[model samples]
Target: MTELPPKPSRDELTERAARVRLLAFDVDGVLTDGGLYYGDGGEVMKRFDVKDGHGLVMARLAGLRTAILTARSSSIVEVRGRELGLAAVLQGRKNKAAGFRELLSQLEVSPEECAYMGDDVNDLGPLGMAGLSACPADAAAEVRQSVHYVARCRGGHGAARELVELCLRASGRWEATVQHMRDPDALQAVKL
Candidate 1:
């Protein structure tokens, strides 16, 4: 097996993260532990972490656009996207690089302004194009090797939250976001 490059230092990550205006993610393994639960009627279900959901909210509050690109189509994903007020929720996009390009066009942001997190080989395209790439701890070997950052937490267990926090802190938006959480009116007073 070939050795991967060393992970970026905190300062390097912070510099890259500071330029991010959008936060994009892959659904399976990155957000939902790559599990597919089937019901008796053949319905599919997935588990999402509440903390991750809140992290998306925080990202939004901090003025970052959020999106999800998944190869599989699921109504659950749509619901979650809507609940989080995501700017985009693209599903059934097997060619993720194309999808990511479309997303960037739709949002009018450059690749250098986006931070992408993914977990498998399928996610490599967008991960390569993103300014700052990340993966969950449970990600595939190739994916972990490809990304700039790897969270300590596994998928569906605050991995997304960890990334969100890193972006917010790196960009110097976390303090105000926390203040806003403490007092909703506090956000209005602080300049982002």
Candidate 2:
């Protein structure tokens, strides 16, 4: 077996994260632990972490755009994206790099200002192109090796939250964002 490439140093990772204005995620392995469940009626079920949802909100509050790019189509993912107020939710995309490019163009964001979180081979193209990249602790070795940061938490267990927090902190927005979240008036000002 070949040795995996080393992760970037903390300072380097932080520097890259600080430049991010957009964050894109792969829905399965990066957000839902890569699990798939089906009911008798052929409905698909996926579990998502509330912390991750809050993290997306925090990113948006801090003036960052969030997007979901997934190969599989799921109504659950659509509802989740809406609930979290993500900028884009693109599904049924077999070629993720193309989808990612389309998302960037649609949002008018450059690749150097985007962060991507993924956990599988399908995620490699976007991850490699992103300004800052991250993966879950349980990600594939290749995926893990390619990213700048690997979260201690697994997917569906706050991994996405970890990535978002890293970027927020690096860019010096976390403190003010948290303060705003705590302010009842500030929270009430935003209509859900």
Candidate 3:
């Protein structure tokens, strides 16, 4: 049998993580509570964490890009992504790696400049390619073992916030990013 290439070690991951300019995540388990509800008319629904929304907003404020990829389509996710001004929103993507590559190419960014957070098998491919891969605390054993960081929170319960904070702090942009958000005069200050 042919030998496969070895995966990047944790130290290499940490060094490369400082260069990340984009942070993307898988939907469902990564963004939502992983619970789907079908109403009487068969309309589907999923709950997104508001703190996760704030995290994405903070990442955007730091001049880092943010996006979402979902294997199954959801109008709720679409609306939330648009509301958050995420740079890319990919849906119905069976091959997450393909979606990730397409988004990176579309954004004109390198994989070494990106991070990914995921929670399941479907998310593994993209996670594997990111400079710093993270997973929710409750992610599958294989997924947690494969990632560089395992969030303290579970999915849809501030997990995104935990990862976003980790990435921002790792890059030394978290304090600036939060201050920018807290100051309503920040944008106006830029104009003066």
Candidate 4:
């Protein structure tokens, strides 16, 4: 089959990214390091970057809905989603496109308002459908070429953090956000 037309301009992508109402990530690569370790207790150990978690919290505070959609079903992924108050946690989905459609319907958000982050072949289809698509630094060349933004950092490192950082900057809140993080204790007093 022939390829689609040339991708939208960076401005269009960034615009979509900035206006995103929903942000969904593929669990393994985008959230974790794409490596799974099995312990003797039959539990899984996945390494998640602290910076990424902070970015996620910031995004949520900014009123953006977040979610995790992955083909693998694991309690680890489930726990992480619950910890973050994700809008959705879809796992063991062989056809991600279907899951995405279901999510869009449930969230009542249009495709153009959704931003999807992923790193492998399984991610390409949903990535193409999203108005703004992104991939980690270690993603396959094909996935990188298909996405509008390719994070400068690798997965499970700071790739997800870079995505949210751009959104924060685009929204003109990066400086204040950094300061807030630095002085969270001082800021907390104002909340009461």
Candidate 5:
């Protein structure tokens, strides 16, 4: 794990989180452990966190749009996004900030209503532009410095889930989300 800077106050975190309508992520170091594994057949192999996927589901249930913006294109990510029902999954994007802007336009949202999580310098542009910026504990030094929140958990180890939980809690929907998960039928009855 990397050394983390001081975290913002809970009030501040919740304040920023409350304004978020869309939450986007960077795929590599944010969702995975940043390990690139290539098979003999040239197949790209990546490990995804089930917890992160669940978090995305919960985010959707809470009425927040979720997206994935990655520089590297991968079929695995595409499948994962589909499984989680993400609003967008943009791969092979050289300019993540530009991609995020396009996503905002498509969703009819503003930067002030977007939250982004990333783990490298490549993510700085989106982080700077987002209303709430977050990163995992093991994120790059510069990324840690730039983010508003640095999760205690490392990447690929429930870090994304942690961010999602923060958003739910800040929006005063965590408990209800938990309850909804317990009673799937009841969740269907209530409108998100």
Candidate 6:
């Protein structure tokens, strides 16, 4: 296994993550391993990590919004976004920076309040604009170097989940989120 690069200091990550209200991601390499599985009908199938989907749910429960921005549009993406209850899903956007800006505007959030994760060069614009930037272990060299965090896990594995846990922990919501995950009813009772 290739050794992962060192990440930013915990204090620095926590500070940036604390200010994050929205978490955005790229779909290709960041979420689906960048592989296009085409069938006989020229339709593409993308595989998503169940853990990553749950991570989004955890973030939402912790009071953070989630979104997806991709250069390609696909019905599968829409299905996954709806299943995860993502706050925003913007697809077929070649200029990711512009798309990210539009999303921020539509969501009424500032760049400083967002955390973005991507795995390729197309993501650089928004990655630079986000308060906290992250990439998967197998991300492009430029992307890995430019990001604030690089996961040990590869894309379509657990990279997204790792970032989500980092943000939740840094923001002091990990414990509660874990408690709820372990026993939702128990946590609700405690809240009551």
Best TM-score goes to which candidate? Answer: 2
- Top-lDDT structure, candidate number: 1
Write candidate 5's Cα lDDT for 10-99 as tens digits. 898899998888889999888998998998999999988888888988999889899998999999999888888899999998998888
The sequence of per-residue lDDT tens digits that candidate 3 reaches over residues 49-112 is 8888888888887888999987898888888888888999989988999999998998998887
How many clashes would you count in candidate 1?
Answer: 0
Query: Which sections of candidate 5 miss by over 4 Å?
Result: 1-8, 184-192
For candidate 1, the per-residue lDDT at 174 reads: 97
Q: TM-score of every model?
A: 0.93, 0.93, 0.88, 0.88, 0.91, 0.91
Candidate 1: stretches off by over 4 Å: 1-3, 184-192
Local distance difference test, each candidate: 0.90, 0.89, 0.84, 0.81, 0.88, 0.89
What value of lDDT does candidate 3 attain over all alpha carbons?
0.84
Weakest lDDT window of 10 consecutive positions for candidate 2:
183-192
Model 2: C-alpha RMSD to truth?
1.9
Model 1 per-residue lDDT tens digits across residues 1-192:
767678888899899999999999999888898899998999999999888888998899889999998999999999999888899999999999999999999999999999999999989999989999999999998998889999999988899989999999998999988888898675454332
RMSD of each: 3.5, 1.9, 4.2, 3.2, 4.1, 4.9
Candidate 6 accuracy as TM-score: 0.91
lDDT of 5 at 62: 86
- Across residues 102-186, which tens digit of lDDT does each residue of candidate 6 receive? 9999999999999999999999999989999999999999898888888999998889888889899888999999887798563
Better of 1 and 5 by TM-score: 1
lDDT of 2: 0.89
Predicted candidate 4 versus true structure: per-residue lDDT over 25-47, tens digit per residue: 89888888989999899878898
